[model samples]
Target: MPEHPWDQAGPRFRPPPGVTLYVPVVVAFLVQVPPTIGVGLWLRAEPRWLLLATALAAASALALLAARAFPGLTVAVVAAIVTADLFLPPEVGPPPIALAFAIVGAIVRGALIWALGSVGAAWLVVVVVGGVNGHPWHPLRIAAATLALALCFAIGAGIRRRVERAASHRAQLVERRRANDQAERARIARELHDVLAHSLSQIAVQSGVGLHLFDREPERAREALASIRRLSATGLDEVRGVLAILRGDDADSTTPTGISLTPQAQLAEIPALVAERTGHGLTVTLDDGLRGRMPRSGIQTAAYRIVQEALTNVVRHSEAAHAVVHLSCEDDVLVIAVDDDGVGSAGRPEGGGVRGMRERAALLGGTVDLTVGPLGGTRVLARLPWEEPA
Candidate 1:
């Protein structure tokens, strides 16, 4: 709905709905005037014939105006004038110039049946009157008239089709844009939930431990305070990284910019994640199969986030003391599974964290299956395609 410059240029440039900005009616009127004057002068006809010729020109001009409201009426008027001109003389030169414009208008405005019927009636009138007045019916003139009418209809139909196609293409583009916006929003939500949930849970646990032991054990309290400080700084830096990405800045650069920085989390970071949870009284073990290099960044990030969320859920909701994280490649697919000796029953419903893990895996062409683990606890298993589809 952007405004066009022509709309602001002047008031007289207004056009009706569905019509182009510039109307061709005035040009049609002007084109009709010269032909009428030319026809009368070329024949040197009597005053009565000149008057009739002038009236035909006036009717042609009126057809231009009438076409804007009733294109079928314009077609009928033009056809009648053409039939009357045929009775005057052989060299009277068909109908007025407005006949072409009127025929085109009728076809473009959904009046094709009316326009063709009018033309057929006019052709019959020409034949009957010519036979009665001793003028032989000319087949070549009739053929030419039919061809001209056909050409007018074809051109009008072509323009209408082109406009329809352009409008359809625009609608498709708008729908695509809306879909992309929704996908980007979902991606951001997943990123924020994964980053904040785990880090805040760790901070909360460490703070509670520090407060409990502040007077009973000073040294242990100092260590807990140190962990809290480190966790806070790490959480702040990760949040800053997300914010920089939102601002369209590159936060993935390994080169330090006044900050102790590491790369974005990937499959390589699962061991560190497990070690961190182990210090918090969760006995965790890790097993790796795909060792040397990883696949695409997206697949690696999704794998890492899935493990992170599963462990976070165990730390926050489960009463488990031991956990196992396994990563391996099977059938050209990266597989990640985490099992915890935590409560696994229908009483504990799945939360958004589980849904977020599923969404992340699905985005990377993967699936997550939740069930009871071998150790009589909850199990979170996921499989991701190693090679991304084209």
Candidate 2:
């Protein structure tokens, strides 16, 4: 099965360690203690009430240590502590600083319902009980508290949104890189197949010819051996060029053998390619109608590969005596047609060679068609979109 986008990005976000873990707890406890201590002494509260207030503050602050791990539970627990503290002497009660942290933590961690419900319920109980005790909070104070809690909620929600957006962007980058890697691998595979298949096929044919002529015609056998050597050298150069490109080296660089790494075959080289095939006993002809009009480099490269693969297929599969390759530009489209007088695709299957041909053409917004030719054999016709040289 295909992988999910998140899986590619890696595991889900986690709270950072070390200082972040303890800082909030320390800060909350510190803030909560001052009011509890100062107000309790100012009110001249009994020793037991002041001690209870201090313990309640400590409990609420310590509860926050678990807020990131269990946001909802921490919020509920802290809210209960704050509500109990509210029942103490009004001036001696500490502010709900720890509760604020719990609410924010809960929302940021996606426990919105728990945070909102607990805080709302606790605030309602305080209001109802204060009114019953004839010590109702002032309207402005209640409104300010409500607004502060809302601000905490807003802050948490904003942080959550930002974190989610960042994660989505990271996932997109990972997916794009993966797609590029797959495409590069496919391109390398096609290049390797084209180089190795054509070279091995030619070497096999030449070796067979040399064996057949070794006893009858030693001179012809020597020519076959020479052809094999030339083909091998060219194939090695092309392979090294591909490897150099894969290694992020300059395509125009040279190998240790002093062979210039030719990145791609151009249209001008097709004639030499045809001549090489003709020398291997496969009579091939080239009809160049482009004159001086050259297509863009991309189109030229794709066209050259299409033509090369087609001719390679003909040499390997076609039992013909002669083949013709015609090139022309019609309606701003580069047209390449290779016709052979072979067995007319009797048992030809759409193998990797044909697929590679189509892929090369498609990459240039072009199409390749295989059909019966007027030469009573197979015809590979490719049309690529092109712009004439200015």
Candidate 3:
């Protein structure tokens, strides 16, 4: 279920549990009771008035125990008790410390209206009733009380804002992590698809050639079997390298499976890739215009994958006899163009292979497109931004 903003904010400033929540209650009780009792005795007040003063102080302190759970009601009850204690003989009652805690608790817990209304009503009653009872009105005392109450509200509001900001930051962190995980998963999927698809397609073709030449030409059949074995071994090594990377191991090191966990194929391997296809009965040529100039590792990887997927599609769908892969750097952009002479891509639906190619190029701020080539077949053109080495 979707979470509300308040629900996310609440846990950070939620009331404490067990004995921690009651610490304030205990402290308030101690502060109120002893002071009230000592003052009443020192003043030699009547027994009945002294007892009333102590009881009022205790009731105000006890009310705070429920302030967290029932902030509005607790504040209102404590306010009434404190006001009643004020009518007692001078210095007979302790300070209204408990009421301050209740008011702050109420405001912090989002009971602002209740807190303000309760305090306003209590203040009005005190002023009207004290004046009627012939008690002198002191402007200084009223101003001090107003300032104290304002400070409590300010403290509560400040605490609430801090908690809310912390909660928001946590939420943003979680969202960023989720997005990164998804992107990593997608990258892994594309890697696996490129590795497995090309490897399996080559294996299938070699197996067919081996079976067909088994009786007519035994030597060619053995050669086909050897090619199948090499493709399978290379495919396994690449898969292990990918797995080692996902396991947080160094891809440049050897793994327990006796496979050197090398990084993915890059620009330097394009000639070997073309030679492999040429050996497999496809006329493939490589034009390396950049010579030894290589782009960064990330761009090289993306470009290599794009070329690999383009070749795989040609072998699987183009039915082309001759193909050419052209690599060049123009104006700080790496351009890869693969052209073939065979049946065109006239009505071929876009598949995962094509989508994977586009995704790889896009990840590196590049693009891949298919068009009719000068060779009268399909052309796969990819352009990727390149950063020249210093």
Each model's C-alpha lDDT? 0.77, 0.85, 0.84
Candidate 3 lDDT for residue 92: 36
* Candidate 1 ranges with C-alpha deviation above 4 Å: 1-23, 41-56, 62-97, 105-137, 207-226, 243-263, 279-283, 289-298, 316-322, 341-364, 375-378, 388-390
Best by TM-score: 2
lDDT of 1 by residue, 1-390 (tens): 223343354433435654531255556556655676676778787778767766766676666677868889888988887677656542554345577777777777778887789988987787777788788667897787778877877887886687667668667766765677677777677777888888899888888888989999989889888998888777777777766676666654432335523326788888899999886677988988787668888788889989999998888888889999989999889988899898864477778778889988887789999989986788899999998766
Clashes of 2: 0
Deviation from truth (RMSD, Å), model 1: 6.1
In the range 200-250, model 3's lDDT, one tens digit per residue, is: 989999999999999999999999999999899888888888777777787
RMSD of 2: 4.9
Per-residue accuracy of model 2 over 202-266 as CA lDDT, tens digit each: 89889999999999999999999998998899789879987777777876688767877765677
Task: Give the candidates in order of TM-score, highest first.
Answer: 2, 3, 1
How many residue pairs clash in each candidate at the backbone level? 0, 0, 0
For all predicted structures, in order, the TM-scores are 0.74, 0.83, 0.78
Between prediction 1 and prediction 3, which has the larger TM-score? Answer: 3
Best of the candidates, lDDT? 2
**What clash pairs does model 3 have?**
none
